[model samples]
Target: MSVVSPRQIAANLAELWSPRVIADVDDSYVKVARVEGTFGWHSHEHEDEMFLVLQGRLRIDMDSGAVELGEGELYVVPKGVRHNPSAAGECLVMLIERKSTLHTGDQVTDKTRSIADQLRPL
Candidate 1:
């Protein structure tokens, strides 16, 4: 397989919050997205979500606490924990989740993206 760059995928992102699948690792798909503002509060009831910052910063606010991540940092939101991810400015992030994981989880928002959309040509 050819090398895939998360940064390159992030750089080419055309829409905020719209993750594009960059690669597949077994049952998980690696994705990249550009983000800013608030992504709304949501939770994955059965799937843990992993977020890795590629550029800028990200803040994930959860009911228990909040975690701030700078570039190259990563955070995993356990399944069933409600959380909201926000950025004061533009940020690029890589996500690793099961193929069945849904964007926005228990809540559907304007920014919600579908698996078909994520799997499209990038």
Candidate 2:
């Protein structure tokens, strides 16, 4: 057993768009991610995702336009809504995904190759 700080992981993370799991429960996982560019446009057919900004800004691009969130703000993307996320600079955030959920639904992208099993801490 060990103590994990999301702040600590965020301060040291080097990946641009990868998420590392810091905590998990029976049906959900809390992951820390550092993003600096645009993510693929995708959707989850059976699960909703919540994104909490720890530092910097994250933009959710929808069909209408984009909504920008700053530190300490949160946004939830509902199931089946097509959306994309982007970060202009380095951003620290947490992603909550259901255990049975696929990160990118049925649409396979290079980023979608990341599996829930690989969400380990450094």
Candidate 3:
């Protein structure tokens, strides 16, 4: 096994909203992404998603309200909860999600990256 740095991995990203798998744990994949602007509103029907802010800040807009997260903060969007994520500036985030999780959930957008794309070597 080898140690991976989220910050370093995020820095290597050349595209926004593209997530790269860094490791696998049990039935989940550990991913890191660099994002700016806003992602589409969507929800995972059968899987919960965990987002950890490694740099900058993230805002998760839900039907109820919005939850803001800063560096080193984390939030879990439960299954079936429609939510959109936005960042005022470049943000680095780590995600822990089921191996079958889709980047854009049920909504396929131009920003959606296929599982094959995400599985590319970092």
TM-score of 2: 0.88
User: Can you rank all candidates by lDDT, best first?
Assistant: 3, 1, 2
| Evaluation by lDDT, superior candidate among 2 and 3 | 3
lDDT, model 2, position 63: 80
The TM-score values for the models, in the order shown, are 0.98, 0.88, 0.98
Q: Write the per-residue lDDT of candidate 3 for residues 1-122, one digit (tens) a residue.
A: 99889888997899999999999999999999999999989999999999999999999999999999999999999999999999999999999999999999999999999989999987
Residue 52 of model 2 has an lDDT of 91
- Local distance difference test, each candidate: 0.95, 0.81, 0.96
Candidate 2 clashes between residue pairs 3 or more apart in a chain or in different chains? none
Q: Per-residue lDDT of 1-122 in model 1, one digit per residue for the tens? A: 89988987897798999999999999999999999999999999999999999999999999999999999999999999999999999999999999999999999889989999999998
Q: Higher TM-score: candidate 2 or 3? A: 3
Error of 3 at 121 (Å): 1.2
Give the alpha carbon lDDT tens digit for every residue of 28-60 in model 2: 877877788898898898899899999999999
What TM-score would you give candidate 1 relative to the actual structure?
A: 0.98
Q: Which stretches of candidate 2 lie over 4 Å from their true place?
A: none
